[model samples]
Target: MPVREFSSSVPLWAKRIASAIYVERRRAGLTQAALASRAGVRQATVSQAENDPRSMRLDTLEKILASLDLTLASARRPH
Candidate 1:
């Protein structure tokens, strides 16, 4: 069987993920700096991931989501 590649598009998913992260961070009363510290990533990295998740690696996204107490399963669903 041939290996198949998934679409590289993120579209609204990135926005939604970004929104969720932003909301959670706010709810936790954390600034971007604090969130970055907790996640052990640069503030800019968080900004980019939140701003454009499409350009991020799955592992990095997973880490960020994990830091926010979320999971990829929650970010995706059956059509």
Candidate 2:
């Protein structure tokens, strides 16, 4: 998959969620390696979630997020 940097122009929620994961991981004192080990995914997958392209499987993303006590939710855009 092609790699892309997250655009600062993107909405706050996107950046917030990403930042939350990083913050929480640090707060929980879990290294990316430890979280990946606990979540049964590769360390690279954890790195990808933090800094790589957004091309991982939804299920895998869900697994990683769930490991961090975060859940994906559906939302309606403001009209």
Candidate 3:
């Protein structure tokens, strides 16, 4: 398998996204594994996103959010 290069530090935007995912995951009462299954992604993928979401792809994020009954539009709006 090829190696992936990640930033040493997480950016502000990534931190915001990670925070949102963590909070939403908790609110939905789903474990990382469960959310991964529902979103058709690996558990590690969810973990990485929750920890540092800078490298998270738009499609993957959309899948995760949709699995949690969320939309990019809703997420972008200030709550």
Candidate 4:
């Protein structure tokens, strides 16, 4: 799948996180229900995270990312 470019209106961090979750979930061939079950969250939560990651808590994001065998990494931005 092609990476989506969020407009300037959306926060860059939220867009990156949401896109990563969406791409990884699709790549893993797991439905929202399956992922949510593994993550110990509701299917709606998974859906919401993929659609609007900024609204999700850090722990919840971590759970979902872990379930998908993905990890969060940070890099310093060039100034």
lDDT of each: 0.70, 0.65, 0.76, 0.75
- For candidate 1, lDDT tens digit of each residue in 17-51? 76666666777888888888888888987887656
| lDDT of candidate 2 over 1-70, digit per residue (tens) | 1233467665555544455556566768999999898778998887776653256687887777788877
Runs in model 4 lying further than 4 Å from the true structure? 2-8, 74-79
Candidate 1 segments exceeding 4 Å error: 1-10, 76-79
Q: Is candidate 2 or candidate 3 better by TM-score?
A: 3
TM-score of each: 0.75, 0.68, 0.75, 0.78
Clashing pairs in 4: none
Model 2, residue 17: C-alpha shift (Å): 3.8
lDDT of 2 at 63: 79
| Candidate 1: Cα lDDT at 53 | 70
Point out the higher-scoring one by lDDT: 2 or 3.
3
Question: For residues 1-79, what per-residue lDDT tens digits would candidate 3 score against the true structure?
Answer: 1222336687656655666677788888899999999999999999988787667899998898788777776654433
**TM accuracy, model 3:** 0.75
The local lDDT score (0 to 100) that residue 30 gets in candidate 3 is 90
- Spell out the clash pairs found in candidate 2: none
Q: Score candidate 1 by TM-score against the native.
A: 0.75
- Better by lDDT, candidate 4 or 2: 4
Query: Candidate 1: worst 10 consecutive residues by lDDT?
Result: 1-10
